[model samples]
Target: MINMQMRNIGIMAHVDAGKTTVSERILFYTGKSRRIGDVDDGTTQMDWMEQEQQRGITIQSAATTCFWHDTHINLIDTPGHVDFTAEVERSLRVLDGAIAVFCAVGGVQPQSETVSRQANKYKVPRIAFINKMDRVGANYQSVLTQIAEKLHLNPLPIQLPIYENDNFAGVIDLITMQYLVFDESTQGATVIKESIPATYLTSAEEARTAMLDSLSTYSEEIINLLLEETPIPEELLISEIRKATVTRQIVPVMMGSALKNKGIQPLLDAITYFLPDPFELGSVAAKKIYKNKSEDIQVIRSESDDFIALIFKIQQDKESGALCYIRVYAGSIKAGTMVLNVGKDKKERIGKLYRMHARTPEQMNELKAGDVGVIQGFKLAQTGDTITNGAPILLESIQFPEPVISIAIEPKTIADMNKLKEVLTILQREDPTFIHKENTETGQLLISGMGELHLDVITTRARDEFKAQFNLGKPQVSYRESVESSSQATETFERPINGKETFAGLTLSVKASERGSGNKVINGLSNNVLPENYQAATIRGIEAALSSGITLGYPCLDVEVTIEDAVYNEDLAHEVAYQSLGAMLTEKIASNASPILLEPIMAVDIEVPNEYVGDVISKLTSRGGIVLGMDMNESIQIIHAQSPLTKMFGYSTELRSQSQGRASFSMKFSHYEKKLS
Candidate 1:
């Protein structure tokens, strides 16, 4: 059961790797648009947001639909910056395949590795598009090598770039053994296929032989033909390559200057030929919950099956309210259908369905299986929520990285306080990585996000889009608290309830767990020690105390708490008394345990020239950075290092001054480490 007529793919790359440009070219060549959109000119359809257009960087993943010949392509253009990594993550969760675009000049950048790892995590097979072949110092071979070395992906080059006097001319299609030259006069709308030139013929043959040799492992027929010295048919080669790609055995590599539109059409053909269709994916594993019991279930990928869709993205529209972007994995869903949101445990009536084209939407009556569309008027639907008609099936929710940075925000005026709160709620619904919480002790509203840029974008939107007036404080590191050693505490809590006195006694022990294991509660007490009704109440109170942390008021992490014993009076002890006793015991252990403050450490990658390497390293080390490793790619020196997020703040500006604007760096949250006194 395979439908070859549909392809759901995403374009991902490092910042400035030209993924958006590739998307723009796809739109123009697919006849979806008559004019090509330019990123520099701020005319690109995929980057439709005003902030994105002004910054010339994609902040959010944008989805659009277009056609390549008879095949319908549902394409998502994802952001490459580290701040927007969650967008790439959620998109990959639902995508059937992806296109990993790499910069020819800046090969294997930090964000490229991040996105590649994300794609790998979701088991989304992807093809490599060596983009920006026309840039100065562009080397597709170097990029290909880096892709294999850094990403650890089996990259089989299917197209060989042809250069004429150090200028990118065209590409030689290895499968067809033909030259592809896009007509510049027609804005690369006309693809001219010619014979491989004499000078490039040998290289093309070598690449083709290498491709066949790699692909032969997937098909015995191809291996037999290669062994017998029989001419392999294009059909056989393509079929074997597609098979390998679908199984993620090998990534078919293509080279192109996406901006110049030299090799886009062939790339489109590769996407349709290699990427898996929904039917090919078969059923997805999910959990069915009924009567407080859960069982594993498979949601079939067919229109006849029960309806199920994953809400991957949520957008707030001024006139229409919330727009929920969904990937329909099971049966069809129509407007006005009553659906159950499994995560929220609420029922919502589907509003209007939309076939979204960036900011524009075309009304649709139904969203069928294997298709991506938007549903409006969902009051309960949020990102990572699974919606179903009645199956009670819960699909795996998308996991987002924790926010590493925070900023204090306050309404500009007392009248704007409610407006700010309302806007924050809307923003949180749209971005899973964005967190806003009220600090009970300080009474300040704190908004946290993945990075500085992430918070900046959110604050801008709150002020401009939602028209909320808010003042922001300086960025701060979102730290956590953890214990270094085990400790035990016992406490008796007594409170007056109604007209009766209630009493309870609890004993608990706290120990450090493995870093990133997070907080876990273990009930060591036998059922006879504590009644089942009060056990849950005690655990909830202990969890709440752990969330408030020890002394610093930061959330606790990597801590294991065990309830050792509980004593309660039959008539005097109630749920409230037990809950209070649990919290008191946890707080008592916090006083005895050797608690430490944990700061977010970042994995930083800096690319600079050899001459500026010493200066950059000196500056980084002065900020308490540790040099992990370094490598030389072409003439650029890439330094891999780790540093505390607290010290690394505003380091980018300093690095620019030190390297005279030649060095560039990217960092992501690596781990939480103990902070020095």
Candidate 2:
């Protein structure tokens, strides 16, 4: 049976695109909260952390549950900033549906494209919302075009913005051919519907016709009705639209200003009507592993199947240890059930289960399939781990990008050393992209992340949340090394340990691959040349060499290594001999391949006033920036450019001073390129 009453959805967008604001409205209108919370006031229910409230940005993903029109919606509000993109990534992996919010003034921003690609990768059906319609220079038509051109999405606009006396008053519902307005007296709780006004009838009819024309492919009856010049039924239009949306053929577009509280109710109605329920998504793919072998399998999305869940997130709780947030895919389990951690290969008992509403939790005796809740008292559960009833099934795990920037950090006082160390451990467990290590040469502690803002957020949390004082050195770019050409090397190892002779011989070749392809190891030797039992040891050694780069001691990328020939002595030579030969030959070949340094390039979008455009461009170009393009929205100028991450460390402050605080920008990792002098 399909569980059509439950929906799993998330709100995702670029920073300052009003994602949290829209979430606040959803909570207030659903009666989960008494009043709407504001981001500027540090009162949003989703951004519960102190750093989030102070910075007015969401630093982590927050999950909650609410009811809309008798439908239970499990909602996740993901972070919009690029630094916390891992939060958005993992959230998208587990979500069946999402709301991709876009700002009306700044259409198709950088991070906006990032989140859209993430949602696309997961095959999550989505509905687009053109938010900030109340802001100046808000162009609904322009944004619609950008969505089609830049995002490569077929945007089906279901509503058209209505302007009365030069103000964003309401919207026209194309499906019902009615004018929908919100009552400010009730904080937009009461929606007022009326016949289309006389002035907007022509435009409304045209839009409704286009909507039906696109949706006609799903239903023959509507195509027949349109051919006969007959009015289409509202039920038929809705049915066809829902079909297209659930299949991800088209993204139903809606317009609203989340801050002004206009057009939110219709968006909520759209969520319930168009978004897919858990049952509609069908079965999930997983791997069944047993006896050192694995096979593909499908886990049915039903409550009667064996218990299975994926822990998508882990949060440390001061009072109750770690909180493992899971989304159940099959069967039902009660509190205190002993579950097997498929990834960890261990068994742990569930101490408590609770349905979370922001920071608060409501205890539950049992959690059923198609539900998202927190499980406590599991010592072995981790992010991306599968928990099952000893089924030996493993689901696909979430992947995060490597950190591209680093900074040296240490506690300000020796008294706070232990506390700071504890904080770092917890943070690393919570976030996969955050990496911390000690420099073997300089003996300095280093922390690396996606960008400078990422490290800033971490240090701020250490001081404010954990009450640990710390200082940071200047930001450093995390460069990578790759070969410029192919090279080959052969090495022979002979050693005597404890009167035992160890001997091994191997030939290795190294070559550069496509940029951003990462490192790969391949075996070209035949079974006669190298036995199957020794391949694992040789490959492991080669991987170890890849991590220890030949040039500058940085990591290696976009490189391929192949083992061509090998000789082993079964009686005298051990695995360590082959491992030593493999590592030695791999490094020698890479060093001979003519290695070069690679740097991270950022795709930057800057919105500045017209007068300061030239100055901004000049400053950016002086820092090795390349101007990609520019767009104009009224008096505001949008500049698109690419610059190295090293030159952008303090660009935000300089831009503010140059533009006199009239310009704002958003940036994200674009790609890695050969470092310029």
Clashing pairs in 1: none
Judged by whole-model lDDT over C-alpha atoms, candidate 1 comes out at: 0.91
Instruction: Kindly give the number of clashing pairs for every candidate.
Output: 0, 0
Give Cα-based local distance difference scores for all models.
0.91, 0.89
* Candidate 1 similarity to native, TM-score: 0.97
lDDT of 2 by residue, 1-677 (tens): 54449889999998999999999999999999998999999999999988889899998899999998768999999999888999999999999899999989977777888899999999999999999998888998998898899899889999999988888989999988899999989888889999999999999999988888888776688889989999877887888888889989999999999999998889989998899988888799999988778999999999998899999999887788889899999998899999999878889999999988887888999988899999989876778999998588998888998888899888888886678778887878888888888778876888889777788888787777677778889999888888999999778889976778988888899999988888999899777777876887899889988898886888888999998888777777677788877888888999999989999998888989999999999999998899999977678888999999889989999999999998988777888999967
Candidate 2 global TM-score: 0.96
Q: What clash pairs does model 2 have? A: none
The residue ranges of model 1 lying beyond 4 angstroms of the native Cα positions read 1-4, 498-501, 568-573
Task: Output the worst ten-in-a-row residue range by lDDT, candidate 2.
Answer: 1-10
Best by TM-score: 1
